[model samples]
Target: MADGGAPTEGRGSVAAAERGATAIADRVVAKIAARAAREALDGVPEGGAPPRATVTVHHDVARVRVSLELDYPSDIGGQCGAVRHRVAERVEALAGMDVPEVAVQVERLHSVHSRRAAQGRIR
Candidate 1:
């Protein structure tokens, strides 16, 4: 009866229907997570390029995989942990999705000297 003869079901159904087909795209979540991860890695002295993120969403849950370039001689476990925690928090807060899993893949490692050398800044 509401909105031109569109039958409103029960109260729960009516509320759900009123919400409409709202969906947060996977890419949006992925980008959010990626940004969070990058921010989390900002403290690393030898941080390299931006990470690559792949996210898959099912209903309200999202699975994210991030490929990162980390510096050698760093706390890999701690950095990865920070990335996972930040990504999940950002995805949940920004995208309103439950992040059940965040798989971090270390794509490459670079030492401090090597990093400077790669940028042609060696003395």
Candidate 2:
């Protein structure tokens, strides 16, 4: 009866650790997303805009999910793959967690030509 409390305390400690890990995972996801966005849009005019991204952390054993809304060009599969790899590397390095997957969602496509047309600079 006296030793029963020890197991409860241990379980509580484990729970606390799990919570901490989750928080770390969330932060890692945000950092990776920001980095990936910056790298992907490097040298672009609107690259400085704040990234529109949503990051969700799962259980400690699972991978994190990052959804990004960005204007991309046609044939963006290569760029998307690069972004995923870069982000996963950063997250794994920072959080010491394995990222089994990274899902990239292209919300829109923006081109200089389109921008000029929209701004009335071109027909």
Identify the candidate with maximal TM-score: 1
Task: Give the alpha carbon lDDT tens digit for every residue of 1-123 in model 1.
Answer: 667766667733566556778788888888898899899895534556788799999989999999999888789999999999999998998888899899999988888877667789645
Q: Residue 75: error of model 1 in Å?
A: 0.5
The models' CA-based lDDT, in order, is: 0.86, 0.59
Please give the TM-score that candidate 2 achieves against the real structure.
0.59
Tens digit of per-residue lDDT, candidate 2, span 25-102: 466567666676557654334532444445666653335444444444545777667777877777677666677777
* Residue 70 Cα positional deviation in candidate 1, in Å, after optimal superposition: 0.8
Off by over 4 Å in 2: 1-28, 43-49, 59-62, 67-74, 118-123
- Worst 10 contiguous positions by lDDT, candidate 2: 43-52
Clashing pairs in 1: none
Error of 1 at 87 (Å): 0.3
